[model samples]
Target: MQLNFFPLNFQFTDYQITDVNYSDELLLDLRRRYNTSHSFFRFGENIYLSNSDSDSGIDIATNTTSKNVYGDNQITASLIKHIFFRTFKKRFISYTPVDFYPFRFFSSKEKDDLLFDLLPNQLKGRIGYKKMIEVQLRLATIAGKQQFGFVINIARNWIFEKNCATLNLEGYNLLNVEVLHSEIYPGSCGILAPNEEFIGIISEIINDETAKVLTNEGEQVFPLTELFIRKTKFNIANYLDFALSPDKTSQILNHIESKKQEIYNTKSLHTEICEIAKALFSSKLDGHSIEFMNKDGFYFTVQDKPLEVTNTFDLKTPTFIFDPAGTKTNNNNPDLGLSNFGPYDSISFDIKSPSVLCICHRENRGYFSKFLADLKDGIPSSRYFIKGFQKKYELTEVNFQINELSAFTLAEYIRVMKEWDQEFRPDLAIIEIPNEFRKLKDADNPYYQLKGKLLSYEIPVQYVLTERIKTYNEYILNSICLQLYAKLGGTPWVLPANRSVDREIIIGIGHSWIRKNQFKGADQSKIVGITTFLSSDGQYLLGDKVKDVAFENYFEELLNSLKSSFNRLESEQGWQEGDTVRLIFHIFKPVKNTEFDVISRFVKDITKYRIKFAFVTISKSHPHLLFDPNQPGVNGKGAYIPNRATNVFLDSETCIVQMLGVKDLKTAKQAMSTPIQIKIRTPQGNYNNPELNDMLYYDLAYIVQQIFSFTYLSWRSFLPAELPATMLYSNLISKLLSKMRNVNGWDADRLNYSLKRKKWFL
Candidate 1:
């Protein structure tokens, strides 16, 4: 297996650095004075300086000391990064730094005219004159070794193509615009600006011609026509509804293969950087120089083979149990399983005759009828819900439709839903809405308003886009019926779990940011926490405890909520004293050490039982990609895509798992799939710490296998999801809570009742 990493070979293990007494003010001044000739970075509590030239004539304080860059992984990594940044900036147009490594890189010359042709008519002349290909790089320790390498990928620089004012006039909300030209404080966006150099977000629109901008100098008025908006994904999406598609992905790959042929060949950039390193550090190293590892080029070949795991349904084969008795099962597929034996837990599902409310525009009545017909009676080569759900689960349908005019407003949607709730309480609702409704603000969006209003009445809603109905197929209905069944409190299948001596509980913590005014880009935004609990078998236990709080109070609230949940479950599940219990937390990307501290303290306090826990973070935003050069492509596309469940251990505590692969890609239009990186946080402190010991003894392989299996448990579709069910469910809850928080009188607590255990968010 080949990674996108290119290894760098150093001629000397130690390099000299000028150590200065670190003060924020002094360090800032030094950086400003020697911005081009030197690199200054902070490590731990101390600051160090590296010069591009041995005798650059730059001076620090008189008491400065010199040291060698040896020992300490963090310090060594920091030195390499600073030196690379100092060298790369002189050759390329670098953008704002993303984390420690400068990920975004652009060429001095235009790569192609692709963006020019793809730009909308209104944005053609408003864009920048130069178009470049953006190259992203990641530096990491590969193959569990201390050796460093750069992971590279290329994309079209759409960000540099257009300006902010062009998007603002094109109907974009200019509340949180990024500024590209600010020198004092770059990439700072919000209301608090300390000086004129710190001018940031547009706080308010004073008039059609003027706006109030918060800068360091104070709240100042600026001409709307003159304000330059930084081109970002948010602004572009809001203005043009742009998203990355297969065609765009293919175009990017093709361009890189042609124009930037050295990237794939791993030749041009590697040699050029080696020469730059030699010039920058040869004199500083006292006679040594740097170069690239020439063994089979710069790419690192992963020595460890990827481990492949398969999902099991009943502690046996990879199959689905279609009935409560476990007598009927199908190993073929989820759809075929349901068609052959019915849904799991069908015997106990009390809903005998389910009533569905169909809402659509009057002009879409024809499409609505056809959709309903396909649901009731299966389309060609598909099993109808009547045969599977109605026959096996005794769930006959009592359906009704309400078609409003095309000009219907949000108020009309509320009125109709309320009337329907009072007259005929529906067990479920299937609303057909136009695609444009997705572009509206959360408070004004009919989709959220209607869904929240119905959910308050204990009715789950499944929304279908009108465009989808026009291109409807049997497979679409299959996925829809699966979600509808699960939403109605029916279990399609459960992951196979071996009965073990220890009890295990998986908790997923997900959050969403709620802006004070979403459209106006208010700096004051609160975070809503969503927590989902699940058994080891991937069964969702209850409704999430959703809470909205200030950023500073989020972690405290999260800890308190976890304690409450554990207390309730101890009594409910009959957890006995001295029983071995394991608590595993699956969270999204966490930015602080507060989460580790919180979970560790919680585990230590539970004296009644022997507790073991794993705090795992699953992230997809990193610049890591896995490639299988020997694998065959799907119809001559995505040849390097690995298979699902293929995992490579980056180190003792980190592993990257591919959730979707070649088999998962149904069409050539799909973009190349990326894997999710899972890292288990090793407990801090000494080996004598019980928490540290427990974490160290836990098998990481078990955690990775369980995560892979849980991805198959998402009832939303038969295909495996990119995220495991724990994270997926929590994210769904967080998104819905954030969207409905703006709806007037929408009580999220209503979910604690009958809908608590159902898949309402599905």
Candidate 2:
């Protein structure tokens, strides 16, 4: 058979995860309703709207789109408070137990030095400042996190004016004067009298003529025309007004940025890695005969034939299994749910051993856990929990009230719940992360606490996924497949009990990329070690998974990290004194030159230890698609047509290894994308080590077999994912780090030490 070899020359760089350019869906809807022409919209530097859209687009969070009408008519900080702060009073009074401040705005003083001193001298003389009102606002607690902010009220208006105008009354001990006041409005409140005076900080601006003011007599609403104010220097040192400073927003985004970066780096790194690999065909290496060892001294390998890889595993094949009642219905709408389909023939696997499930959930944590526990061997055929949670138990969306949470959030919660009932303590604690948890912007996020609390339990914690209260459909036989896999410890990915690979030591590496929270408008990134690491024996090492932000931009720091990882792994896993160790790095993206340099330095340093490693990348993101040479196209299951073990050498640098392929299927909509590209790189190749190059094997079938097995061992998902352990590890660790960083802040010292060799993050 003829082989095609492709040359490698790809552009690679530091992949930065940026904010999602969210199209203004609200604006789009508004435009659709009003039938606004596209040409009517004109974007300017400081506006999300055009001149014609006056006062229409006000984003309270940043006030970035706020602007005065023509003639430079602007209001002072005090005036802004009376007019706008009253609209957001409820937010300040009883702050929600959430991290994002969607309603906070920039204070007027921040944008203009004139702190509510907007009245001209002539106007101030007309309405002399005499009465003063002092408002005391008790700070609100955010999910128990104390926060400070202030509001200033100076001018009041009586009408909504296209050219709203106002002359500020003279102030006392404090401020300077700037910005004209216009865009006056008249409503239920009477017009302000030119002679009205002494009505200090307006607590609420009600209509045009009415407003509540905080005087020595306490809060009372008076006619706006009767209100007046003087100069006051309010000590607003630590208030997090959006315009005053970006510190609060920065803090929020910074927590999520790490998480986002970890994801981006993992994907991009995988891409960069696979394309750069060079094939090192070792003539003596056997591709079919596999032999591997486990810690138990047992050996394993592929038997007579490999099992078929289908979209749904055997446990999930419902083609033959049907509803006992043979019920009929309209098109299968998931929203209508599976209830109408009648009694579904239960799909059960031989657990062989009795097992208990511990569902670590949030929100109605205990209730949710109990719900899953009640399901014993069955999944909900209907979407019951989501529809009537509030109705049945008064459960609201946000769970700021920890006591009312009825779920496991803190270690105390776990203890309390378990002690309350023996049923709460299961044999395996599955931290089935709730999807909503990822939307959080703080340290209180449940993902940050999953590890430190659960691993201490007497039983095993086999991490797995369940469908959301809605369908959490990552795969068809999700819950069952995961359950069986957890119980049996063998999948299609596992080799026969009698066979094993020939390698003595196998190393797997994964990468993580995270970014600041995009919603917080802070987008910094870091490559972290909170990634995956595995051995050939399908085992995880604690030290290897000891995650930290990878030192980037500096080769020296990366060098230290490399040394640190190997040292940690060697110490924890008990390295063999003389056995040959194979290091395999699985990256989803390509590598940058600088990153290559770091790897080069690492390889050179490791030579002192005489370790043989292959820095390889396996990517599924490229444009390249592999198909069968004989029969190409769709399969009966709607999966693509490809031979079960098709191997294509696109070039000397790349090979497409089809691990679990099918040729034809008509039962599904889309065919499975089975081919994965593998590329290998050597630090010595860049170093000109001819001897090192000779020792490595470049067999496509061999590597493919290892990768296929790796996919089956994922601790997270039910089915074998497209990703392997090396890349998968980083995804898990980076994700935990990202979430934990939000709650724990930047102090990872605890994580480094307390969880140095613990699988707590899982």
Candidate 3:
């Protein structure tokens, strides 16, 4: 049959050339669905991919064989399978049945769907990838023998709660399950398990006597008797929002709502947030000089990071983060924590300082191929600034690319890294990606997929952006500092030791809200506060719980909550009963003096123990914006901003801290970052010993330093903390409990006793 290729724009009798890449139309088709520009390229065999950045950039890959792919997050496994069919158009290439996503990644829900045979190339040699990839293996001397167990989501699993599979799972079981068939409580209408995480409209009453419930855990099938219905239909505007259906059970919901209504009484909490605009710079605390650091300096800790006050919290050694699934070898014994290192800070970052780079990337935007093409045996472009870094830090350089997933999902990142660790252990892992991908950390892209999966396990990781590595010469030199920190790891380069009289403990409270089945067809929500107590040295000891109570009352509720928190530290940490203690409470937002009136007429009674209470609110969101546009000694590029650890005290008790950098904000691409406002108020707060000079005893600098130091401690990010440990740990725990509220049961006493020492929240 004779065929003619006509122009795309030309009119045809009935047929149309819809897709330019597949159709061999002579002219272009501009008047398609989207009104956007397009780029067409032809490799061998006229290979073409649609290029439209406005259409959310595309990813394309081609192997020497028939394996090929091109799409914007849409190229499924079936789509890639067609490449073989197209390559061997004259004959059939398939010999066995094929089905599966090309990526090694799978959601917790997709466990049943995946075929074991046609998995990602990285998993071929590994005996079991799922357990390793999905779990982080940590060793502990339970009795005496070293037992290997998974850290689960923290270090090993990148995906954590970030499962993108919209596919329905069978049940909400085992996924953040809190109470497992523990109680049978009476419901408003039907006797129920009030805490059934998934409350959905009965889609179908199956003949199997099961009810279909669409929950946040995805669609689930529950036995019909397991389902609970409100006495009346309370319509929900958004179904995906898994709120307690109106009129399920009010044991949790009604009480919280009643408290909030009684607490607020007014329309809002407060109209005016007192801003201490006039403030003096606090330079010292208790006669000790305070220092500020831009970023966490990779110090020679264990030895370099001299311990001022010896504490039991152990610092982990230098570690790597990457998915080892596709790698040909398994790291049977991944070097985790400081087990083998000598007395000094030996096992920390300076892990045999002639440092090595474990390069592991998904689709590297061809940087991997380009770097290799330029230097067959020498350093790739990704390590362009390596020489400068080496000269700067005096270290050796070796590249070890841990093969795994790219264009990876959260679960995939975690699972692959877990599995890969079985074969390979790295001092530092590199997952080079584009800057755009790093920013889209929304629910869609989930930036934590890369950092969270590795960092939580204390695995040192570096995300080398394609923008930074594409042109080795143009890589930001200042960025080398952190890399040096990672390569030559140890304890953080902290400020000089403070006096032993540093008597202070902080309580961080994170607020998370959940739904409770309410009476009279009311689906109301209650805000719960999760708290963690940190000793003076930023050691997280015990976590406390305050159910749905804000900063109201004679502050008795908060003080009462701290009684157990205080007792635990005293008994476990040897803090005595009569010793004077400085209690600092770190909350999320700014509060008025009304919230800080602890010593006011409202409270006639005080604790027997000597206590000085301070209320400091750390604003995660504030209106304050700061800039060091033309600071001398720093970069003069109009874009340059103050380095991390910048502070501006508005008053003795109020300050603004630039915990992170300008690079972390939305304006990160366009402008410098804004600082967080720290508002403080002390009502009859006095921690001074009679001998100390008031002028030299200035506490603001020390308080500010404490806040800044906690930022670096969060394994959540390599960046300095935006929130302190008390708040950071609290925030994490609150989020975990809130997210898995269906399973999160709260017994304040139980949590302090059981979970205080665990990192289960992370």
Per lDDT, the best of the predicted structures is 1
lDDT, model 2: 0.37
| Per-residue lDDT of model 3, residues 652-700, tens digit only | 5566666655444332222334457666654433324232212122366
How far in Å is the alpha carbon of 34 misplaced in model 1? 6.1
* Per-residue C-alpha lDDT of model 1 across residues 263-363, encoded as one tens digit per residue: 33222333333333344334445645333121111111211222222221111124566765557776647666776667677677777678887777788
lDDT of each: 0.63, 0.37, 0.38
Candidate 3 similarity to native, TM-score: 0.36
The order by descending TM-score is 1, 2, 3
Q: Give the candidate number with the greatest TM-score.
A: 1
- Tell me the lDDT of candidate 3: 0.38
Model 2 over residues 633-709: C-alpha lDDT tens digits?
A: 34334222454445554434455565554532223433344367677664532656665564455654455556656
Q: Report, for all candidates in order, the number of backbone clashes.
A: 5, 86, 32
For each candidate, C-alpha RMSD in Å?
A: 7.9, 25.6, 30.0
Please list the residue runs of candidate 2 whose C-alpha ends up more than 4 Å from where it truly belongs after superposition.
Answer: 1-503, 513-525, 542-558, 561-577, 606-610, 628-640, 659-674, 684-686, 690-697, 744-762
TM-score of each: 0.76, 0.41, 0.36
